[model samples]
Target: MSRIQLALNVDDLDSAVQFYSTLFQADPAKRKPGYANFAITDPPLKLVLIENPGHGGTLNHLGVEVESSPQVHAEIARLSQAGLFTEEQIATTCCFATQDKVWVTAPDAEPWEVYTVLSDSETFGTAPILATGEAVPDDEAIAVCCGAAENATAPGAPCCG
Candidate 1:
């Protein structure tokens, strides 16, 4: 099954967790130091809250989660055929999961990803290395991960907020 994913940036992890727990009537399915995710079946939503101080509390990125890597590739091909595929990440890890993803930009330059999670991981993935073999800085990586590139925001800019 596929589900809509909405990630949000919040200032306080604890407060956000409590609020969402109450609102959803359930605890987070996954929790970490600065992140929490509630996989709600009733609404079929994957709601993620990330603690990022200085970023205004707002929508971070939007995504569709599929069941398998093949589905991810199919979506990538479909989006590419439609001239929407902007970037692709294979076997990359983010948000405590290993995923294969393709990024597309909306009409307003908002980024959307169609992805499939492969497995859980203890840590967020390592720094992304560019094709030139140079490591992407953490700040830049965070921006890229959260779809800042589509809006032409600088690395570490308030893209989500």
Candidate 2:
């Protein structure tokens, strides 16, 4: 199975690392001059952070996983139905690999990319890093919208998964 990947821009690498460590509850799998990454196995997610020279703050991009090309198309349709903005797929090469995917612009204007690999030989290079989604201010709302509500303890809403 493929993993869900996420990347974000930070103002301070050191502070971001400490904060993320508390958030992810684990040390970073890879740390560099202005970046840090974590591979979360349990949920099958990959996360990375990069220092923004001019910009400062959190809330990057969003990414979702799909199995095949058909799945990607179906998800695009589904997200469109939900009123999400999606960009057309443009054939290109990145990270030395060919990708078939679309970019999504959420209601909040955050960029989200969805892609499928035609080949895995492009695993080298800078690695396909992405931007952050779900802005910082929306963190609490995201928790609630994503079902993190503490008061949502009824049969319908489960407490903190």
Candidate 3:
């Protein structure tokens, strides 16, 4: 069973835990100071709630765990067919280690990736530089926002604890 994890920043840990527990309709399987986790047995999603004192609320990222590299390729094609505009998919490393997979984006501007690495490492392969004339989709604009106007970029792209 693969798991999808989401990290959310909230103002209060207790309140957030309560709300999520009621929302998920089950008690968390794990709870620690300033952090809580609920594992959904239905769809099997693991949600992590972390208390950030002045959080200002923002979604850190979204992750999807797939079984293999072929699954990653399928996800990219699926994203493109859905018209979400993928920012060029490339074979690159991520997280400090185990950086093998593909990333896609949702129409609502959310990034989703299908990956299959388990260990945490300190180096991911560098992303290939996009050539000129590649249009960056709005969903993936956040990645190339810092003065990368020279290359035409695609959309879709993420990280974690």
Off by over 4 Å in 2: 1-4, 12-37, 80-84, 95-97, 119-161
Q: What tens digits encode model 2's per-residue C-alpha lDDT throughout 63-152?
A: 654567777787778878888766645343432334556666655555566766555332222212225643324223322322123322
Give the alpha-carbon lDDT of every model: 0.75, 0.53, 0.54
Candidate 2 TM-score to native: 0.50
Off by over 4 Å in 3: 9-43, 46-57, 88-91, 124-161
RMSD of each: 2.8, 13.1, 8.3
State in Å the error of residue 143, model 3: 5.5
Q: Write the per-residue lDDT of candidate 3 for residues 45-156, one digit (tens) a residue.
A: 8676656566516564466666666776777788779775555433444433354555555557555555665454443223434477565454344343211222212232
At residue 19, candidate 2 shows an lDDT of 90
33-75 in candidate 1: lDDT tens per residue?
7788898888899888878675637667788989999998898
In candidate 2 the C-alpha lDDT for residue 123 amounts to 24
TM for every model, in the order presented, reads: 0.87, 0.50, 0.47
